[model samples]
Target: MISRRAASPKRSTPRLPHLAGSAFRSRSASPLALNVMTIITRFLSLAVLTLHCVAFAAGCTADETSTTTTLSTSSSADASESTKESRVLRHAVFFSFKESSSPEEIDAVAKAFEQLPSKIDSIVDFDWGVNNSPEGLDDGFTHCFLLSFADEAGRAEYLPHPAHKEFGDTLRPHMEDVFVIDYWGDANEVTDAKSDDETELKHAVFFKFKDDASEEDVAKVEQAFAELPNKIDSITDFEWGTNNSPEKHDDGFTHCFMVTFADEAGRETYLPHPDHEAFVELLKPVLDKARVLDFTTK
Candidate 1:
């Protein structure tokens, strides 16, 4: 009944010597020291931020340089490929059949020559036609056959082909004269604009430069010939190159130019064209022999 009051709980203050000392020292610090420390801290933060920005900018520049280099290389490669695709080796053949050969025999010879392309894989394209130009400029040639190849190697393969040799054997009997000229030219596709139906007149011009003609003279002649299409409205297409055939059958003809027209009217217009006449005058001095054959595509 008379229980003693529970002993009162002891009240004790917690020890904080380290915290108290630090707080007292901070409060006693000079304003100049505090400002100096704040300035140093801000300067260090800015320096780190500047370094990060510099690193990021350098990385971006390197990436951009790499991308630009790659694009340049790709563009150059594409341009080279386009140039290669546009060029080809052309083998042009002109024939004047013997008077003794009948039409049926000539037709057989034609059919036999046509078959060589199918047999020889090197022949990329083949086309033939009889002379139809009223200009009387074909020099006794009656038939024109144009064969296309990818390069000199393709032409090399074609020249010695067994099928081509057989075709030659078949053609030699009735062939009064055979003119072969090979050159490099544009690989123009026969599209609607240049289709056989529209642009069929082919004016094949072959040249044998004089021994006295300098390289520069020949170059001038070649340049003048190339400019004909630009000067004459009737010229639908024009391509030219030097002969590079290994067959030794070109008979000294060095350069070949193939000019296309829509019809005989176009040919008629082109022949008397002032530009063409001027070109001929320019060519006269350096030219040794010139062979021109005009035909409509069959």
Candidate 2:
């Protein structure tokens, strides 16, 4: 695979996460509107590591079949440069409840979050998630979602997506408390994240290697690192890859990875798994240079 530079980080908000009702008990919306936003603020408090993905973008440019199956597994950041900035920013939606809800209820909300894709607005990207921790995060909430749009107008249209509002109404009875936090994020801050909190889950991470690393050699390192997720069950979502081009760098930096867990414990479980230990061993050899960044959404 030919290497291309990584794409620039477009300033965007984080997506709200969606957890499965089956995953945990649902919390009722708290009496305080600010309570929901506060939790998200706590999440934004974590850094979101951006992996340079111009190479991943190049990889994505291949034929249709490869794009979905092969490229999905590509190692490193998958950011694409987005220009024509407008009122819309990347939207990160993070919410948690008090307990687990039924699968049907979970599906209802999942569908609500899903409506943004074709909500008749300027939206161009959307993704959602369910909390996957095995237990311990006794909180009633169970999901988080991240949605991206071309501009703020797209976001405005989304608020009343009739469908989304319906989702809130549908979730009202099953929910104990709903939390939300919205942040205006920049690519530079995301890629160069730092943090002091050891309890929250890490968002984005950055790494840079010398210019001499050939595309094939880079591919080998990724192949070895990709298997890290296989080690355990606590990992809710895992995405890791490298920056394709040096030219795309906001700085000379070039690679990064991101992992999301149900809570801090899920992340902690994955850290010591035997397979993860091996992954560290494999990565250390190819890692001529590296840096680890961790952050939350707050």
Candidate 3:
């Protein structure tokens, strides 16, 4: 819900039209009677002016009240959308299959995992793909699945949901080691899958800072990092947030930044851009360790 902080409307003094002085004076009238008549005329004119002001102010108040109501309604809608977006809980899973598991078995597990969002109503976003990065940083994990939930309650429901449990059963036999990390963040930067072969690239960066790094240094890094898109045109979408998960799988990483590019060439330009190099210079001092993962959307 939108909270209104608007001030009360101030009352304004009405500007009265000037009246001709001689019009209220009668030439043939007695002095006493003229004086009384003048007083009575002035009173009536003043009363008319006050009435006109009241009527005009009332109409203005009515119109202004209607406009405020419309603005408030629109703000409430925006607030609702923001709240929905903010509550997104990202569940990231990296799976490594056992040596004995065949490609067909792994493919079956992947298919079953992909069906979870359709089976569960709480799942807001879902994407899964095999590791296709040229960088050898993926370790042994080959498959990555990203799932989004609207809230913790949605995740709670999903944890024991029948379909999820069934998928877990399917994955249990084939999986050699599984690494799961959950964080409440904005994952809307990642796009959905398409039926066509065309796929976009996502650059995911995780940062672990030195223990002595101050909040100011981190804020500076964040501010400078946010300015990169303005300097480079290849960035399609960008979002970053601090880690908010209680899960110990984070491995001391606290910040995640995801940048989207239209193609690998776009990423190539972004990597070599002088602006990116400068930003990296600012980040290098406080950054103790970093991991980068690049993948194409499925």
Candidate 4:
């Protein structure tokens, strides 16, 4: 009786949906729906990888730009520091007022001259004082002004400046004579001498060599003068150079020697020192005119 119904048609079970070669099977999804979801997941992963690569590349570029800028800034600072350390141009000016100029007028002229440094940008250093040399070799020059510049360009700019031109106008009527000498010198020479607590006395000497003097004679004189600092204990600092001014105001002076002393006693001892006298003996024959100006720095 049970085998009798077995002849009826047999039925097969339905298969679950799954991706090709996948172990997982889903009962709720169709094959077409699973294919779409797999495609979307793969595309999202690729998109995330692309975003990470772009962010990394941008970071590298930013770092490189920052490094280059830092290097450029460092180089400029080093060059500026080196220039400040090496040397500076010196502008030494001396003035003598006319006999007709009263003290008040002379003082006004000096005040006006002093203000130019503030008004002119190229004047780096400034100092001035009245002559107090007991040696009486000033050649009627009563006032001395010392100014400094970084280089020739700075001086060039200062020379034609409106402030300097105005100052010249104020000085012309009262000025009897003007002497200017420009030279390049070590930056630390004057600064080191001035660092001391004692008051400084500057002995500035200018000489116009005789027309007949030989170059060898001039060299000997320069060497002998240079040796005075080594021989004389009273000389605090010493420097010398030939005039290189563009203004043609040296008044026939060629060589300028600057000697610094700590006090009046130091200068007094230096003036009559045996070594100085010996140098003077060597200098007199070749020297045509010597102008000496001594002042206590203010």
Candidate 5:
């Protein structure tokens, strides 16, 4: 992490005391004895200086070690703060009810899901709606729900919460096909039903690659997908990311891409564009299963 404050310099070693030669001199002693006394005093002073140097070096090492530990701790804390500020975990769910299920039953399931955030504290945001796309590409899925968490830990808490399990029980009997994709990305802050009161069309596409697909093959698909906006003119906004949730709820889908259109006319132009057709062919060889959910903001 980048530090806002400047680093301080290391403290300097202190000076040793000066030794006086006159203290070692004995005026009453003979020349040889006086010479011996002077030598012994000089040796003892040199030893004291050596010991001081060693102790000073050790102190410097200790200071250096302490500073390093402090900086490491500061960086870790800053990184935690950055993660908190920049990212959010998104839980994307799509459900297709069985033929035997009644309208009242589906409504109950939806209401039960809406009430989950009240029981599970980890869910920070929730949104749900019925499908409203004309493309007929949703693979039988009719309802969609999006749940947001502040971080992965919050998501972790939400998945196993009793409320979530209860909601699952409500959904299981009527569920036909379920597709889930959770990932970390920028938090959604679009609270308005429509942008400027005009219905906005959203194209949510989920992809599951073949088990044998190489990393290179996946990269190629990603590159081709990203190039669609430039190849087609109707795409107003686009974003893509990989799954990161640990809930095991993804059901083999690993990548999600969302494209926003200003209106249904924009989406119609994109569906049959030559570039898009070509991109689909590129995805076919390594693609395992794919699902799409297109909806207009209510």
Candidate 6:
């Protein structure tokens, strides 16, 4: 759980924030206290991963784009241009990290990144993560994440902010490899916001499991997600599934699950829940290469 509000300064030896919030704020780490090194690390992670997703999707064959155009009829490239104009994907950075990263290391990395992740103005939804796995594949990157905003300008504002750049400077040396991609969230895509009593805090967690898992594995995972909504008092919504990305975009990810809450406060409530605890126990056996990204988005 990361949020902002602090002085601008670097520590001779940086320490990441340990949190405890109001559901959203871990009771431990409240609003914020600057940890320059952590911010730099998250920024670097964000940019490198962002580029990775774009690079991966950029592989979609132009021929596929052409083939999708009605084979029934098409005279020139002009008609294709028109279709391309009608659909554009808003891009976000997704990073996959080494599987062996310790919880302390991951938490340390997440903590240093204490910047405000907002869904303000213009167009899309924004998010970021730690990878979960049942082992085997690791091309060095495994922590998949999502980034969204109102529109391109909103993202542009985020790209070169002092906070972002500082992160890039710090993370380059320690990183092994990274990937990023971009996509759009259509304004037409309708999602019903939960009612008022639920508005004070809102959060979503998205994760996908390995594609080759058995049916039983998936069922176990769903049970885990389902039990989360019940085990925690604050959860208002919970859903799970396999991803429906255009086979072209899904790479290594397959099964997906998401849970939403009024805010971080309610979200934190689940962290220590017993069902969530038991589910965690059940999960280790059936899950594979799982990825988790938690964020505040509407």
Every candidate's CA RMSD: 10.6, 40.7, 17.5, 10.9, 17.4, 40.7
Residue 48 shift from truth in candidate 1, angstroms: 2.2
Question: In model 4, where do residues sit more than 4 Å from their true spots?
Answer: 1-85, 189-198
Model 1: residues with Cα > 4 Å off, grouped in runs: 1-33, 95-106, 120-124, 131-142, 150-162, 165-179, 192-199
Q: What C-alpha lDDT, on a 0 to 100 scale, does residue 273 get in candidate 3? A: 93
Q: Please report the TM-score between candidate 5 and the true structure.
A: 0.68
Off by over 4 Å in 2: 1-88, 97-101, 133-140, 185-298
The list of candidate 6 runs beyond 4 A from truth reads 1-212, 247-251
By TM-score: ranked, best first:
1, 4, 5, 3, 6, 2
Give lDDT for model 2: 0.52
On residues 183-232, what C-alpha lDDT tens digit does candidate 5 reach at each position? 76555443323344566677888899999999999999999999999989
| Alpha-carbon shift of residue 207 in model 3 (angstroms) | 1.6
Indicate the residue-level lDDT of 57 in model 2. 64
TM-score of each: 0.73, 0.34, 0.66, 0.69, 0.68, 0.36
Question: What does candidate 1's lDDT look like per residue over 29-137, in tens digits?
Answer: 5688778767888999999999999999999999999999999999999999899888888888889999999999999998998888779988888878888766566
Q: How many clashes would you count in candidate 1?
A: 0
Task: State, as a TM-score between 0 and 1, how close model 3 is to the true structure.
Answer: 0.66
Error of 6 at 211 (Å): 7.2
Supply the global lDDT for candidate 3: 0.80
lDDT of each: 0.83, 0.52, 0.80, 0.87, 0.82, 0.51
Per-residue alpha-carbon lDDT of candidate 4 for residues 5-106, written as tens digits (9 for 90 to 100):
768787666776455655335556767877887898789999999999999999989998989888999999999888766777889999999999999999
Better of 4 and 5 by lDDT: 4
Worst ten in a row by lDDT for model 3: 1-10
